[model samples]
Target: MDLSAVTAALELKSYNKVADILDNLMLQVAADGVAFHNDWPYAIHLLSHFYVHDINSARFLWKTIPSSIKESKPEITAVWKIGQQLWLRNYGGVHEAIRGYEWSQELQGFISAFSELYTKEVFQLLVSAYSTISIEDAALFLGMSKDDATSYVLQQCWTVDSSSGMLTVKKQPVVTEQKLDPRKLQQLTEYVFHLEH
Candidate 1:
């Protein structure tokens, strides 16, 4: 498989797109009856799935990876450790796994992207799930220091009570507008009128 496109995507830090590219390449190789496990970068492929927050796919991919490959390539196993943490929703473990490993230059982009995406997701969850949260928990959820988490939440207009050591989350109003297609509505109206007449 020509990895020029994959190299380009990695160079551009288009981490989300890498998984789809690899998925397509894998399909192509399978169609051609080519044995690709030896040449394929499973570690990056696994990380790419996590980068997009596709935990189920990542889990499936992990299960599909050959045991020999998993044993020989410590990096692949390390990447799966993060996947396992994500699967279990072990927020602290996620940060630890990502930070604990020395990732290659090629895979670093995906790891950074995954971390940012995970932090964003956890922030969204916090906004909807909690009106107020302790600074330490917020720090763990955001993979930041307590001071940094306080600063970050404050920037999002979340209030911090000095005495309580808790940050009040600023919930953004969810505007869900139901837009009915005018043409479809009109067609339905006409059909109703015809049936009634």
Candidate 2:
């Protein structure tokens, strides 16, 4: 299968589309009985899964990759280590794994985007689960220093207790009347269906 579509998606910085493109390409390659081991950059494909927080798919892809390739490419191993940390929900380990590796040019953008997406996800979780959190824990979750995390929370309108070094999460009001895009809804339905099976 031609990888031009995947390349185009990446060029457009459409991380979400890259995964779908690769998924289709993999399906087509399987149908043609072609060896997918060496033709494609599986590390980037795996990172695409992480960009969307699809840990199950990333794990499945890692398990399916040939042992020889896994042994030969340290980049693949590095990416998988990040996946493992994400799978375990070890937020601090995830940050450490991301920072510890020197990702290649091809993989760097995806890794950075994954980190940002993960931070946003963590922020949402904290907003819903905690009325107050320490600056240190928040920093770990956001993969930032205490000073940076404090600034970030404050930007979100969260209050800081200087004496306790705790941040008060300011939950934003839910917008009930917002319309959902049909295209996005359809894509979500398909994604959930794929996950269910």
For model 1 the local lDDT of residue 97 reads 94
**All candidates' lDDT scores?**
0.89, 0.89
Clashes of each: 0, 0
Over 1-197, each residue of candidate 1 has an lDDT whose tens digit, in order, gives 89888889988887779989998998999999999887789999898888887888888888888899999988999999999998899988999999999998867777887888888888999999999999999999888999999998999999999898999999998899999999999999999999999
lDDT of 2: 0.89
Model 2 worst lDDT run, 10 consecutive residues: 35-44
For candidate 2, the C-alpha RMSD (Å) to the true structure equals: 11.9
Give the TM-score of each candidate.
0.85, 0.85
lDDT of 2 by residue, 1-197 (tens): 68898878887889988888898899999999997787677998889998886888988998899999998898999989889998898988888899998999988887888888888888998999899999999998888999999999999999999999989999989878979999999999999999999
Compute the lDDT of residue 68 as modeled in candidate 2. 91
List candidate 1 segments past 4 Å from native: 178-197
Provide the lDDT at 28 for model 2.
93
Cα lDDT of model 1 overall? 0.89
Candidate 2, backbone clash total = 0
